[model samples]
Target: MSPGGKSAKSSSPSPPANYSAAGEEFIGVDDFNEDAHTPESKTGSAYLEIHSRQNNAILKKNQEESIETINYLEIQSFELLNT
Candidate 1:
């Protein structure tokens, strides 16, 4: 083996960035709506920003779970070989 060690032969495909948890795609609008007066009625980019944050949160959770699962499997494999 080289000093850098061996790299894996297979890699998992990355999740799509545009997809949401509920499979909803964001369609943004061009208008900022200056005459709306109040902020509650006119949501120019809030929805998109919130949805993007939600997607990021879910992805972080999944990544954490994947690490835990990988560690568990490695321990089980070692036990099996020892037995």
Candidate 2:
């Protein structure tokens, strides 16, 4: 170390400073597409085909269960004298 102590060197580049204002048109929310944010699945066709079949089966099972539950509720509601 030198008797007069100072940092040897700096190697970082300085960033440029700039700011500007510009005018542009603004549109209402009605113009926006709802699907813009949801990215489409990129899975290949074969994988999607297998997944679709599995999902269809699961959906049918769930739908059947839902209808059964609804039927039970409807019967229970019919038995209730007080609203």
Candidate 3:
């Protein structure tokens, strides 16, 4: 450390307040592209294929369970209202 109370290391220039990693500036509404954020098929195929049946079944089961839970809650609420 220098006796002058300042570090001797060279400092890099700081980015501007509006600087963004996405680009030079933050994305604006006019610059927003809905399709740009959508996933693209690197394989050049339009269809997405799931190679794992076990994973697919697990996801499906979870979805079905969620739907069943929602339905049960709705029924309970209805029954309470009728009471």
TM-scores for candidates 1 onward, in order? 0.48, 0.44, 0.37
Tell me the tens digit of each residue's lDDT in model 3 across 1-83: 88899878767665443443344753332233333322232331222234356679999999999999999999999999999
How would you encode candidate 1's per-residue C-alpha lDDT over 1-83 as one tens digit per residue?
A: 44579765546553334333355543432333333322233564565567779999999999999999999999999999999
The model with the greater TM-score, 2 or 3, is 2
The lDDT of each candidate is 0.60, 0.52, 0.56
**Segments of candidate 2 deviating more than 4 angstroms:** 1-43
**Lowest-sum lDDT 10-residue window in model 1:** 31-40
**Total colliding residue pairs, candidate 2:** 0
Candidate 3 clashes: the total is 0
Compare the candidates by TM-score and give the number of the best one.
Answer: 1
Clashes of each: 0, 0, 0
lDDT of 2 by residue, 18-81 (tens): 2111223223322323333111223333445677899999999999999999999988998895
**Candidate 1 at residue 60, lDDT?**
100
Model 1: colliding residue pairs: none
